[model samples]
Target: MGSKPRILVARAIFPDIVERLRTHFEVEDNPGDGIWTPDALAARLADKDGAFTTGSERIDAAVLAAAPRLRIVANMAVGYNNFEVDAMTAAGVQGTNTPDVLTETTADFGFALLMATARRMAESERYLRAGLWTQWSYDMFAGGDIHGSTLGIIGMGRIGQGIARRGAHGFGMKVIYHNRSRLGAKLEAECKARHVGKEELLRTADHVVLVLPYTPAAHHTIGAAELALMKPTATLVNIARGGIVDDAALAVALRERRIAAAGLDVFEGEPRVHPDLLTVPNMVLTPHIASASVPTRRAMASLAADNLIAFFDGRGPLTPVNRPVAHPRGY
Candidate 1:
C-alpha cells in the first residue's frame, strides 16, 4: 500500500482547490459531475482515508460500514443534515461543516430577497419586458413597503441576527424573532429587536423571513396552517434550507393570493421548483444562491479543505461537527 493518505472529492471544485489537495494526498475527484449511486460511493470510499464532500453526499452508517478505513468527511456546505451524526459517531468517523465564512454573504442575499419580494421587483420587470408597462399609472406595481415595516424572523441564528440588525437599525423597521431558545437580552438590545411566539410573529409582522436550520422536527415550520396566520398584505421570504417550508403549500398560497407575495431562494425539491410557484404572479424564485458570493464560496471550500488537512496531520479538525467521532475503533 502507498504511504500517502487516499481521499475522494465527491464533486468538482475549484481547480486550484483540487491542485492543493493533490499536493497533500492521492485525490480521486469526480470531475464530470456524474451522479454516483450509494453502492458506488461505498466502493470508492473503501480504500480512502478521508473525503471532501458537498451537501449532496450522504455520509451515513451503511457507507461507513463499507469503508472501515475512512476517517474524516469534510462537507463544503454549512448545513450537515446530509450526514447522519449518530451513525458517524458509532462508526468513529469525523464530520466537519463550513460555517462563519458564508454567514455575511448569506445574510446579504436574505435581506435582498426580502426587499425584492416586498417590492415586486421580478414581477414588475417581467411585466415591463412583456410590454405591459406601455402606460404608467399611480398605482402601477405599487408593492408592499419594507421600510418602517414589521420584520418577523424565524430561527435567530447568525444569519437571522444579521437580517435582524439590518431590518431594525438600517431600515428603521421593527424586528421580532422566534428561535429554539431566547437570545440573551444584550443580543436582543444590540439587534434592537423583540422576541415573540411563532404565531404572534406570523400574525403581526409585515414581512416574514425564515432562517432556521433543517431537521425533521423543523420540517414544514411554515405550511398551510402558518401561512393562514399572516396578513393578506404580508410578504414571506425564505433563505434557509428547503425542507424548512412546505413548497407545495407555499405555491398554493401564492397562486390563490392567500399571501401577498413570497421570495424563495430554496425549495423542498430544489433546482426543480413547484409548477404552481412558476404560475404564480406574486412570487420570486431563485436557485439556492444565498451563500454564493465569490469570496464566501472560496472561504467555505478552503475551510472544508483545512479540516481535512488538519485531520490528516494528527491535529483536530478546525470545525468538526461530530467531533466525538474523531477517532476510530469507536469514539
Candidate 2:
C-alpha cells in the first residue's frame, strides 16, 4: 500500500484503455490476449492491486488466494458468470461489470440472429455456396414468418425489453416474456410485452429468444423437456451465455427436425462447440460476438477501466456486483 497500485489487464483490450489505466496506476497488460489458465492468471495478479478483465477470464477463490494485494476486479462484459462473486466477496475483493452500454447493440444482434434463423439465411447461403442452387422453386428454403407471430423472450431485462420494442413496434409482432420478476405495467406497455409462464411462451410463440444471465440455477434452461414444449416450427435464439441452453439436446432436436431451426451466439465450452451442434444443418452458430460491435466493445473496455480507476481513486466501484465486509489485504 506504500507504493502506487499495480493492475493487470487480464486480456488484450483497446490500447487506449490500457493507457488510460496507466495514468492512474502502475499497469501490467497482456497485449497478446492469450487465454490463460488459473495458475497463469494468478501469477500475473499476484502483484496487482486491481485488474481489468474481459468476460473470458475466471476470477475465483484460488486466484484470489494467490493475489493477496488485489482489491478490485472489473469485468468488461455485463455477464460475469466467469467470476466467482461469493468467493471474491469473502476474500475482501470487489467485483464490477459494465452494464447498460452494450444493451442496445446486443439486442440488435439478437434480433438479427432471429431474423436470420427464421428466414433460413445461413442455410440458404450455405446451399448456394455449395453450388446446389441450380433452380429456384416457389417454396425453396421457406422458413417461418416473423410478422404477426408471437415472439417469446426469456430474461426480460434491458436487452429483452429492447428486443420487445423492436418486435412490437417495427415488425407488428406480439411479444411475450418470462423473467424472474414481471415488468411493471407502464414498462410492459411501452415494450408491448406481456409476462407469461415459460411453458406458455415456449408452446405459443413462433420464435423464442434467450437473454438470461448464466447461473447454476439457470443452466440448461432450454433442455430436452423445454424444447419438447416449443412448437415444431418455432425458431430458437440464444444470445445469452453458454450452458444456458443444452447444446447437445438442441442438436438432437435440430437433427430430428423437432424444431425448425436455431441461432446460437454462445455455446457450451466455447470456442469449442459440441460435435453434434457443428454437424446440425439447421442451426446458426456464432463465436460469442453478439456484443462485439467496435463502439460497444470500446465503451465496455472504457467502463471497466473506469471502474479500476474509480476504485483506486477512493471513489469505490461504479458498478459493483458484490460488497466485501473486510478491508483489502495489506491495505
**Top lDDT model:** 2
TM-score of 2: 0.97
Runs in model 1 deviating more than 4 A are 327-331
lDDT of each: 0.90, 0.91
Clashes of each: 0, 0
- What does the lDDT read for residue 2 in candidate 2? 55
Q: Highest TM-score among the candidates is held by which one?
A: 2
Candidate 1's residue-wise lDDT over 169-263, tens digit each?
A: 89999999999999999999998889999999999999999999999999999999999999999999999888888888988888888889999
Clashing pairs in 2: none
Please give each candidate's TM-score: 0.96, 0.97
